[model samples]
Target chain A: MNLFSIFGLGGNSHGVRKTESSGKEEHFTDTYILALVHKLRTPLNAARWALDSVIHGDDTGKEAQREILNEGYNKIISAINTVNEILKAAEMDSKDGVDLKKEKLNLCDIVDDILKTLGYLIKRNEIKLEYGDKCNPTIIFGDREMLDLSLTNLFDNAFRYSPKGNVFVALTREGGMAKLVIKDDGIGIDKEDMSHLYEKFHRGKNAKVVDPNENGVGLYATKKIIEMHGGKIEVDSELNKGTTVEVDLPID
Target chain B: MADFTNKRILLVEDDNFLSELLSKKLMESKANVMRAADGEEAITMVKANPKFDLILLDLMLPKVGGFEVMEAINADPKIAGTPIIILSNLGQKNDVEKGVSLGAKKFLVKAILSLDEIVDAVAEIIK
Candidate 1:
């Protein structure tokens, strides 16, 4: 849908040019809207990037500062989650439904690409970041960007809470649906937190370890993105042990 | 070498407050700063003084847009190679990609960055 024609008020309305129908005004206005959207999203993207950096322990062996690095990473993630919630509230139509441009995508390849871009984080944390080869070029129908962002948030979370443990990402096919599994041996959530995991601003007890004002919204946004793609997310975890998040997405 | 110290920079932005604040910051770097609230004035000013070392552009402008200004500058030989860095609030992957492909050297999102960061980016790019 051309958001410009739909969201923009007509020329008859206020400062808009009605007589000069060059579409130049419309085009320029559309560009401005696009720019504004990007402007607003950049900070969120930066926060995600910054968090990923801290979680994956991208800095040199500054073992003494690991605690600060870990806390900073978690705080950045919290900030990104907060921004995502704000965007979700503002982009009304976008939140409820996602117009996923589905294509035949290889799940393994996609995960590889995401990890490669984020290699710095993986290497810095000394955490193992690898996917099972069984993924087998799975074809799925979903918006690539939405899928990537969801995966990024999940993997990022796994890496942050489990800095000293291995982070395993695996993909499996079952019952005609593809499942992406991200597991981590970090500070897993208590059973109590799982109930409100998908609720915006709901944070676990350990969330305060990162920031005092923690708004646990990352999983919520990730859940929305997944559901919008016609997928389901299930979490199985135990405090102090590990957590596993399984995303079941349709194969197109 | 072309001296960038006294050279003027054309900043085209719609927001008056930001325009003034940014101009003041850039001026502190010893560069004579000129303001164009819209694209038309930007184009006219560039045409008059093609010697500008840099063009700090905003993606959103009133009359003419940043891309249009870029097109105009790129079409002319005099200011063709002048460094053009996008100082915009638009930092989306696609938007930043488009600006760079259209000759913008760097794209900075305004909200996440401060005036000092902008000045530093300008200094580094111009240098």
Candidate 2:
């Protein structure tokens, strides 16, 4: 099962609904451009203001100055990453898909690396994570970097949306497929937004309320990557309750 | 040069980093800064304390938007008199016109203006 089948997107998964009239398409294009502008502008604004404060401020200690400079650097890095994500998405949207370096990978190692990278966020948000005991060393044939990016997006969403909440992750092999499940007791999706979950630049209303800074590109890119790996991803969510995302990949 | 001694200002911004930087800059100008991270809190604070010398508002807020917060403030005669300068990244023509029509004293795009310039704008309006 592909992303189109899972999300009911029906051939136009890139957010342009070909069935709509020309006027609606134009509106969609305008809205998309506006959203993109807002996304790119935010980090730039933050970085500029941080540097300006450092330059124009008076009686600031060295420690505080260093902290502000670090923040500015991080924002610039974030902006660069956003640009890279946009470029990757554009590449995937083209007729020629993204070029991936395929290799044999252990899913467990990828999960561990991602979790280690997210250690700071977990500590800061006070999230309780449950994993490893139920996880088996599942092997898969795919691009390690692409799979890493996709899984990181999912795990990041679970952590970002569910601060101070509980997350349960499990991976096991079932027949010819390796199944991975991530469940978070975070703000779940509204029923109205379920159908549009995988659409490009589409953010749920509740998600916007929780984290307005999100550019809504994570899931879109994640779905495309998963599809390229010949994997199936499914999500089950209820408003205010929690979310459960299951990904199934063919075993090597 | 921008002296806003004892002047009270309300800052309505959702981004934590930008809010902290702006608040510090405003405080450096000798202004008392009060912050509301979302539009709902901004409206509530404005209604409760309507004597602010100026308000710095961001448009794309969480619970409610900046424009709606301004509308709510305008609905109340006491708070409506307070000056508002919009601090937002959205600088489209329609957005500017809407902010102006909603009684914002100045519409400053965050990405375009420096922190000092924003504080200067606040001081200019309040003075």
Candidate 3:
């Protein structure tokens, strides 16, 4: 974070001068790129490690090899998604941003699809998963696929972080806006992590210390999608307690 | 002959497939493994069952992440002295340093390390 050039401390101080604003912008983008690199490498590492394990284990059986192949495929897909997210985040810096295919989409339908996809894990983990009555067929105006992905990331984090705890999700129409409240009674996040939570490649300290597939890009991309929909996301968390994320998107 | 006949071990991980693989391998070694899918579960299990010979901790978990789990384990007077080996995919110096600082005995990255390497480390430490 120390950009000596910003203050013209060590860059041609005698004759030429560096514009403070330009230097600051450069420093900001530098940090952003560093984080983006980290995000890209995470999925790459997963794919590489999976491939390496497959090779190292020497499992010759058809079933064993097939399982490894499946793992690799998932890892690779994850990597591709990460790349697309990074590209999308970069595109957001432009005035055009996201050209979302806005449509009438049911919030319940999207949530249910994601839940059904991950139902096995939810059941196996003994989690008390709930999508309350408030979530009953709430309609929203937004890009269906984009909202689906954004909500998926939100739910994914909620479930991944909670260890045999409750995941409560509710979609309600407020006075003027639609609200999505997702609360998890798992491990909470650190206060320091909140500021950078939406940054392109910022993972909380505690989040990085665990053995789950967490790419920092998920939150970033989620934030981007929300912003494109003219929505807001807020997080409330306490260490060792739990986290509640509330996303407010516009409605018809 | 089983390498760890009746030895009790606690495995902390979030990835289901990886956890299953390790659990199966540990069972083959004759070690009784109790798994915790997240950091909170690991801390709770260690406190509730202090008799476990070893705690295999994973850093990236769902609810309670790994460092907090280690700190919680040490915070509990009853299980304060439980032996914990850090296991996670976060292969960075800061992560390893933080885990060690939280009283974890050793750090093992899941991505680079093989099952045999981890198993051997566990055997050596427990023996």
**Highest DockQ model number:** 2
Query: Of the pair 2 and 3, which is ahead by DockQ?
Result: 2
Best by TM-score: 2
lDDT of 3 by residue, B22-82 (tens): 6766776889999988777777778777468888987767668778887777777787877
| True lDDT of residue A57, candidate 1 | 29
Q: What is the overall TM-score of model 1 with all chains considered together?
A: 0.45
Clashing pairs in 1: A39-B89
* Candidate 2 ranges beyond 4 A from true positions: A1-15, A19-23, A119-125, A133-136
Q: How many clashes does each candidate structure show, in the order listed?
A: 1, 0, 10
Which stretch of 10 consecutive residues in model 3 chain B shows the poorest summed lDDT?
Answer: B109-118
Please give fnat for model 1: 0.05
DockQ of candidate 1, scored on C-alphas against the true complex (2 decimals):
0.03
TM-score of each: 0.45, 0.91, 0.59
Model 1, residue A208: what's the lDDT? 35
**Deviation (Å) of B1 in candidate 1:** 31
How good is model 2 by TM-score?
Answer: 0.91
Error of 2 at A173 (Å): 2.4
Write the number of the candidate with greater lDDT, choosing between 1 and 3. Answer: 3
* TM, chain A, every candidate: 0.61, 0.86, 0.74
